[model samples]
Target: MTPIIVFSVITGYFGLLMLISYLTSRKSDNDTFFTGNRKSPWYLVAYGMVGASLSGVTFISVPGEVANTGWTYLQFVLGNIVGYVIIAFVLIPLFYKLNLISIYEYLKDRFGLKSYRTGASFFLISQTIGASFRLFLAAIVLQIAFFDSFGIPFWVTVLVTISLIWLYTFRGGIKTIVWTDTIQTTFLLLAVTISIIVILSQLNLSFDDAIKLVTTSPKSKLFEWDWLSDRNFFKTFTAGIFITIAMNGLDQNVMQKNLTCKNVKDAQKNILWFSITFLISTLLFLILGVLLYQYALANNIPIPERTDDLYPLLALNYFGLLVGIVFLLGIIAAAFSSADSALTALTTSFCIDILNIRKTKTVQKKTRLYVHIGFTMLMFLVIIVFNSFNDASVVSAVFKVAGFTYGPILGLYSFGLITRKKVKDKLVPLICIIAPILSIILNYNSEKWFNGFKFGFEILIVNAILTMLGLWLITIKPKTSLN
Candidate 1:
């Protein structure tokens, strides 16, 4: 009858993951830790990324997004499919051709050390904040679920949760993460499907009937063509394209998995398959949300103050004991699928980028252990900072922060990869850093000057363009030598 049971089950699940991590990590060295030896199966990585990409934010936030934006978020998912195709065909091939350990290494080869470090440092900062904020959101959920029964402080709960992730990921890195993520994704999807069936049964409706009810519901209707508003079709699709491309294509955390594929062909296959799977899985969640809302309405369940709790609250309270357990499992599945990957990717990037450990042939286990622990503690610190703010929404704030930092990154890469014009390496970092700040200022008052048309995801597109322009302006032409 209390959250103690829920918490216990969740803790046990984490224990299982840690056990798997230890088993996988027993003899893992630097190559295995960072690249998974470039031997990971593409299918496994693709399937696992379904869960990693969605994460706790999607588990809670997608339902809330529906409540606010209707089913039009699917447009963004559609855009993601397009973005994935582009990455599979365009970006992955380039990365594979370069045979890069860290994607940022390409910048160094093309431009100079300053560009390389600039890109890598930006990723470290953004991903660290992004990953920490994600864990903080999940920790908040756990805190709320256990507030009465456990009497644990929020920060303590965060440390306990993150420490478990660190323990699992400290050794095997991507090899361990690939398999574990597949397991976690299974639970995530299964939990949602089971909860959906339970909610429908309580409504005395069959699965087909539930589908009909949802399609007819206002929330389930898709296709919004308005370009002037928040969830507009063009804007959502465009935003989706940019977000997925920037986040998945340009990001070290996400792309590291792709780069682990045996070859460019395999990596491209993974991206394509991942696109299909991600779209289908999200559709399943949205359908579950519609059914959940219908069940709540039919039974007169009181909606929570924040819509994020709608799905879980309905299952835990309205559907009662068995379904409550299932709901808790879903929440935990979504949260950990993401947290584990984030932890692994965070350590992998740091080891490869900031620390430059990958350049060496011999890295000690102790060094890797300390590196993993440092990132683990960093997660704790980031969550504390997020908690300190307490006002911003986790998903939106992350995107906003990303918009500033990642936009310039997108531009820098686009220029170097697509253009022949050389950029001044010394000025690259400064331009990349300043572009986002200026974009933020422009975006702040964009609507005031544009007749109430606010900038959306296109901000990243523009930000990247500006960086490209800056790179062009700052680069000095080659001079005639003494010959």
Candidate 2:
């Protein structure tokens, strides 16, 4: 597991992605970059999304979390299934019927220009931070495993990380991502499966014995019935539903891929198939967590201070060179899968939603190329910032922040879909801003006011509700034509 081998593996992986990008970007246009010309195969999009949705955060953090929280995360995963179903039936039809390139266009048609820009603004901010945090985690791991050995600085690693993604994704956009993501997803899943097999062999446990071991272990406990706990099944499940809606259905990064499909039917199939694969993939990660813990306990190894470090520690140091290589590939694949798409989505949102590049129909290629490069730089700077101040668990930090930033998106979409009331267009920004602030205050003091009850991912639900209520306060009845 020398740094040279790790570096070589990463180089080879990036080369493959670049090749895919070149093939996809040939004779590409703005339509190809934005929507893949509405010609993407549903099955490929479904398979690729498994990697983008999970990202590097899930790759490293989910297994780390299993040691502390056991199987309760599965409750969140179940809730995601419900959310995906809603997207397939409800959101996909709306996007398709409107023939939307940017989903935020619905906001303009439903409300006004202010609402549309507000929605896109929130997404840009949300995806920028989300993408940076994800890359930050992956960069940190690379720094420790490879760069540190050579005394290479963290900032250089961040630049190289982002540069590689930009190189592959700059030209093809969604079209390229559709294919690269499938390859990355395959590598990610393969890495995890192989690591699991290696660990199982080390433990000398058959498949049935491994299943029984995890099922019977103390960490196997799944449900939390108490309402006061943050991990309460009801709270986590509800949060999962809203999180998926906000983070996927309303998100340009996720929805952009869905929009690349041939039609609503293809998009629906993609969502359905992706949801099923995502469920199975998550379950496998949870099982991997249980095995890692059992192996550590049996071998008298001390668990790392940060739970996220456990999988990397075992794969690199204890499991053998092959396992370590797999771990590196898995994490790099997970990171690139999400980051490349995020960059494209941000560029798409800004060019179409903010700058209205499609409407001008002039110098579109140049504008999009510049925006893509701009976002890549922005992401690099943000990841550097995260390295300075980040101390909490990466997965928890992502969801907690998402609850606040994505809350307005949830509220905006909920209001548009559920009511015919028109809101004060100029005041929409104020409402979106206040909702997350109030959610922060409430989350910070829930224990004092709610008799010691804590908020979990459910904070997202509360934030969206507050935003919706604020919108309702400013709503006015639609005027009918009296011809």
Candidate 3:
């Protein structure tokens, strides 16, 4: 629990990551960095993705949220199961058939050059914001447990930790991450498993008793039949489906891992198996949440005002040494698993989609290195900005931002796939921009204007619909060709 122990654990973990980077990336090139030479194992990719998908937000925020919202988040996970199936069956085949390096390349083939860039640009923006939020959570925990003891500032902690991520990821890129994620995912799962065992032992509760304690507690309340609440079952389940489609199916970072699989069948297999394992991991975290609150109450520990702080506070100060060590490792693994992938995916997007260097061998490697460093710095700044203004739970904040940023992408993919109509390509960017702004406006006024209707994460669905409408307005008639 001391600063020295926390710092040492991080140091040792980072050293192991660097070693993995060295082993996996020794023979790496631009091809390996971008797509892992299309040779990653389906099973490992599926398992590691469990860690990347959860990230620091889920590690810190989800359990804390239980006291407030209970098992309502489980509805969203059920919807994610539905979404992941759609990705495996519907989206993966399209990417594979097109032979896409950047999935946004589908936009260019389906629509036009401008539409492609719009899609890629939105991904760049969305991934950066989302990645920053994850890293910000990790950085805050590190600052409190380690740096604060030495009077170090938050920015310095971010810079140093992010530098460590950049050091490991810049060379091997996604190739290293695939292997590294497997290991990190192990640590992440272990953290949860160990916490559950420790809490159960401390409370003298067996497996059956723990289940009863959770179910019998008022905090375990799941469904909200009320139509207007943000966390209502209908809204969350529906929102989870769309959010996964947009955030995972449409996201370059998440899809990048899937694309690394050897072929279409492998990628689909990876996603299918990942959904099953991911559901198990999520349930474990929710169970841990219940145990954490119970532990706090029985021992006369005062809960922190912010749900995000509860796990860290209890583990570091109250839950004793072993849980504390595992907690730090788990959070670090969760944050870096996603952040490292995001950094690689962003660099890949810029070099391939924005710069059109996917075909050019010359200067591509050098250019990629520069872009990698540039995104690292950009994420550092974004984390600082988020730390300044983030008042809501990090999980809610991530999805709220995703609604506005990722919505246009969902619309673009839907428009191109479901309909053959082409749009005035030049207007695509304007439509993407306007859709999110309008969603924000509608969200602000919904209670009054919609007769006390509160928008949940369903705002993402509305934003995507508005974008599709805009695209339809700009559609040009498909020219009929005689066979």
- Between prediction 1 and prediction 2, the one with superior lDDT is 2
Number of the candidate with higher lDDT, 1 or 3 = 3
Clashes of each: 0, 0, 0
Write one digit per residue (lDDT tens) for candidate 1, span 151-241.
Answer: 7788898888888777778778888888888878887788777877787777789868876888898988699866667567888788788
- What TM-score would every model get versus the actual structure? 0.95, 0.98, 0.98
Q: Per-residue lDDT for 1-483 in model 3, tens only?
A: 888899799999999999999999997899899999999999999999999998998899989999999989999999999999999999999999888778899999888999999999999999999999999999989999999999999999999989999999998999999999998899999989998998999899998999899889877888888887898899999999999999999998999989999999999999999999999998888888988999999999999989999988887787779989998999999989989999999999999999898667575788999999999999999999988878889999999999999999999999888998889999999999999999999999999998888999989999999999999999998788999
CA lDDT, every model vs. true structure: 0.80, 0.93, 0.92
- Prediction RMSDs, each to the true structure: 2.0, 1.3, 1.4
lDDT of 2 by residue, 362-438 (tens): 75899999999999999999998888988888999999989999999999999999988899988999999999999
Q: Candidate 3 — which pairs collide?
A: none
RMSD of candidate 1 to the true fold? Answer: 2.0
Candidate order by lDDT, decreasing, is 2, 3, 1
